[model samples]
Target: MTTTSPHPSRTTSPPHLEVTWTDPVTGRKGYVVIDRLVRGVASGGLRMREGCTLDEVRGLAAGMTRKEALHYDPGNRYIPLGGAKGGIDCSPHDPAADAVLGRFLEAVGALLKHHWTTGEDLGLRQDTLDRVLAGLGVESSVEAVYPLLEDPAGARRRLADAFAVDVDGIPLPDLVGGLGVAESALTALDRLGIPRTSARAVVQGFGSMGGATARYLARAGVRVVALVDALGVVANPDGLDVEELLRTRDALGGIDRSRLRPGDTEADGDTWLDVECEVLVPAAVSYCVHPRDQARITARVIAEAANMPVLPEAEAALHARGVLVLPDFVANSATNAWWWWTLFGDIGADATEAERKVRDAMRRLTSDMLVRAENLGITPREAALVVVDRRLAAIEERFGGPGAHAAARREGSRP
Candidate 1:
């Protein structure tokens, strides 16, 4: 079998997981990052890319566990599908990659009796997921299992439903991520003393995450001066017509460059980053703005809509420059929220009720973290550590301490 590179996040040895795949004939490797399997079953997406690794899968799986918390907090107690993420080190263009993916899915499907479900991410597209699931004859999928719950973004439940639905058996919902980003932006805006309605923003990425966020920001009266996709970026000082652009955007988040006049633009794909606006939303892929590009960022508040889109060093640099930095984990709370409601249908109330819950949860999370940062005179990340410490103490008291106090307190409280 072809030897895969070890996960960067892992040491020489860490843990042994049950699910693994390596085809000898083709020499390919596929893996599952089983983060947590609380309710018997574990579910997550399968990413296919040239450099996919076990370590990333591990982290993504764990993130799914936390995401479940945001969604299925109370009524949906048992996070049924323990979180897991699979990865194949084959980019979309490689024929060998597709073969590896199919075989890997079939190989992994052998254990589907364990209630393992899969979704789409990275190089794995919806159609590819279908091919894999179909060949493997896997049923009782995760997307179908996403319980109908209300969404806070007005399109909340549907967002969850849409994300959970395997567009050909591959789920790609990041509404939770988007919501968290908006929350972070809001926090930054409040910090900058800018009203949401008064802020002009630029959005990068036309995928569901970027598209939905841009629409929400516009709805909230944030003028998006520019937007970009894989093909290129676009700008309009008079306020780019989002609707018209969406009409022209391709499925891969492309903007028609045929209508563009060059020279006035900085870069196509990175256009949104250079927009002369108060806020910049990097809702697409990772490292769109690296350290070298940080100086070009015109936005006072850079809200990360994608996971760890900015490098850690760059993030620190941004903070030092007095640009408010919103950590991805804190900003992207929608994962757990969507996961929970999609599983249990929110016994608390209807979709609206469920949405309110998500907002309250996120608002509390962002606000509390920001408040802590302000109070301690530290970055939000540091303040998050404080929040985590207190939460751990609470968990210890409730579940482990001799005088454990897991009792629910009144709304809006700590301890």
Candidate 2:
């Protein structure tokens, strides 16, 4: 473990706990930030990517805190768990990733056992996490259990025996998260009195989340006229074939031009902001939309599927223009699904049931929050934060701050 260093660009207030360390074996650096804790519990995902930094982890951790407070327990029904995030500054493609991950788990063992729970994020796979936990002799609170109500016991048993990991309750990596974004986008459209059949959509990024969302929107009768990837952008007014595009996209969401045709025009990926569409879903890298991009945004509605995809200034600009913006926490179901399953157990007995449960929950929550915000004459983001703050404040008044188990921190760790 090494001492944490200061990053001058970080403008946010200090979190409850922030620590950075490097694995003695693989030399992989990692950061873990606990934004706040409610009744001694804080949780988020572990994301691995090259060039990832402590400041990024800190920002993400704070977003998780807001996500938990607003999306998980908006009504103050249960204790408001703090938000936390972990990041490993290494490529997902690194051969030594497993060793680095194991060391990370070991280093953060105290936090995991006591107050922080972690699952998958951008580059970390659940299967890897499962293996690491098994090797560490740590029991997972959210492991897959079999004998699904919708599946025959004998068949399920045979399948379970054949597979090394249980597949019964495991979510489809892309679908669960994308389904939430699609549902929220539809809710926003409905709130604006726009019908799905008439909505034209542009999806930025063609990876799992973006790919899945584009497919969902197409299926729901929305014309996905554009698909943006790291390599280039493909646009067609008559709507691009999502299935074909998905088959042509690389693992990192780069589209192969060889598979495209004459009718589709290729442009810079960032030009997605200029694509005229009723809906724009940014599921790509964060802060893709800066002030200049915001000024040229042609979409009537922007549904965030990536954390902090729109910078604060751009988001404010969109709001001022009367464009309904669904923040990432509210629109992205990636984190919500895992945390929800962890808290309430399985959604249902089958894939259909699970998907339906997720869709219903996302639609209901988005609708209620948006409608209330409109009635109260406030932006959706503001409304969400206010609701979360109210609940957190109530808990603080009742239990006092830091409720028992005064946060876990290295004795000499700096803020």
Q: What is the C-alpha RMSD of each candidate to the true structure, in Å?
A: 7.6, 7.0
Global fold similarity of model 2 (TM-score):
0.80
In model 2, where is the ten-residue run with the lowest total lDDT?
2-11
Candidate 1 to native Cα RMSD, angstroms: 7.6
Structure candidate 2, residue pairs in collision: none
Indicate which candidate wins on lDDT: 2
Tell me the lDDT of candidate 1. Answer: 0.57
Deviation from native of the Cα of residue 25 in model 1, angstroms:
5.5
> Best candidate per TM-score, number?
2
lDDT by residue (tens digit), candidate 1, 23-115: 766666677766544333456667776766665666666544433432333234323334566777667678677667767776766445454
